[model samples]
Target: MASMLKDLWNRFAGGGNASVHEEPAAEAVEYKGFRIRPAPYSAKGGFQTAGVIEKDFESGMKEYRFVRAETHPSKDEAATFSVTKGKQIIDEQGDRVFR
Candidate 1:
């Protein structure tokens, strides 16, 4: 029971299954002067939809990360969805997304 408790603790604490293989993040795509990188991660039942948006400024750089409620059975689909959602966000908010 001790080993089982330890395993449960690790899983809930985000340190379990270090040997499990993780999918590589999708390639970053450029859109309207912004860079979008899909970075979906494995979650229960499916891959979670998430990504990062970045822009370069004269002074430095800005970045924003987003996670959506959507989930997909395949990592590729999740990544594609992440990019699509990122494009929508960029189109809707532009640089305001940073704030």
Candidate 2:
């Protein structure tokens, strides 16, 4: 009875297999004068995102931007799956840029 009570207490106190799972960090990729890194398990459904990263060469300080690459299923062709919506950031001149 004592062992069972202890086990119950441990479970309620978040001590029995309630540890947090840490995901692996993603490597940064450079493109168009900006670096992009994937945020680990931060999306709505445990998916990673391509985050814009900025680094200062002199101080080696890093910054993370909120803009991310996202894919959405086509509403019109949900069954046929003809097209997918993609997220993008554009500049005033209609050029793709990292936010």
Candidate 3:
């Protein structure tokens, strides 16, 4: 019947009770002195790293460096070194200063 056909069409074509969702993925964070890039293939299966950190101590002087912090294979970690000018360097915490 017409009703039966319409029901079948609605079931297949209509967005009814289907679950719309997505898996959470890692995020990137940028700072004044550095930019963090996602590197999911590192020792950790899902982790991000600082692609480049530009530091200009004196005028017309530039330097680039890479930094990594200790973290679980799945969770995000802080940078091993300071990524910005205002950020503090705490030694008591797990934070490190990589030169």
Candidate 4:
């Protein structure tokens, strides 16, 4: 299957431990009844804008992760942009983003 091939490729390319570690996540920011955690990862000679937005629903906790094309020279700048983007997404889409 395609998944099997992808797994094989990952093992060969990533030494089979790609999922074991990750860049430490930034502290969560509470905003508009949601939690946004910036997680900038180094990429393409810079830090890439990334983050996770979460909310507690009656059903359960829901989360959405975003990675923008924007990159910054420093992790702090990337994280700042990530939070801003997360806020924009929440303001524009709200809970419908989890849909």
Predicted model with the maximum lDDT: 1
Query: Candidate 4: global Cα-lDDT?
Result: 0.77
Ranking by TM-score: 4, 1, 2, 3
> What residue pairs clash in candidate 1, if any at all?
none
Please give each candidate's TM-score: 0.76, 0.33, 0.25, 0.76
Q: Count the backbone clashes (under 3 Å) in each candidate.
A: 0, 0, 0, 0
Runs off by more than 4 Å, candidate 2 = 1-25, 42-52, 67-99
Q: What is the C-alpha local distance difference test score of candidate 1? A: 0.77
| lDDT by residue (tens digit), candidate 3, 1-99 | 897455434433433331111111233344444333332213334332333323345464343333334333442342322232113322221223334
For each candidate, the alpha-carbon lDDT, in order, equals 0.77, 0.33, 0.32, 0.77
Higher TM-score: candidate 2 or 4?
4
lDDT at residue 61 of model 3 (Cα atoms): 35
- Alpha-carbon RMSD to native, per candidate: 6.3, 13.4, 18.4, 5.7
Looking at model 1, which ten-residue stretch has the lowest summed lDDT? 15-24
- Mark the 10 consecutive residues where model 4 has the least summed lDDT: 12-21
List the candidate 1 regions with Cα displacement exceeding 4 Å. Answer: 1-24
Residue-level lDDT of model 1, residues 1-99, one tens digit each, is 898567535533447552112333777899999988887777667877778888998978898877677889998998899999999999999999988
Clashes of 1: 0
Residue 28 alpha-carbon offset, candidate 3, angstroms: 9.6
Of 2 and 3, which scores higher on TM-score? Answer: 2
Assess the local accuracy of residue 9 in candidate 2 as a C-alpha lDDT between 0 and 100.
Answer: 55
State, as a TM-score between 0 and 1, how close model 3 is to the true structure: 0.25
Q: Candidate 2: count the clashes.
A: 0
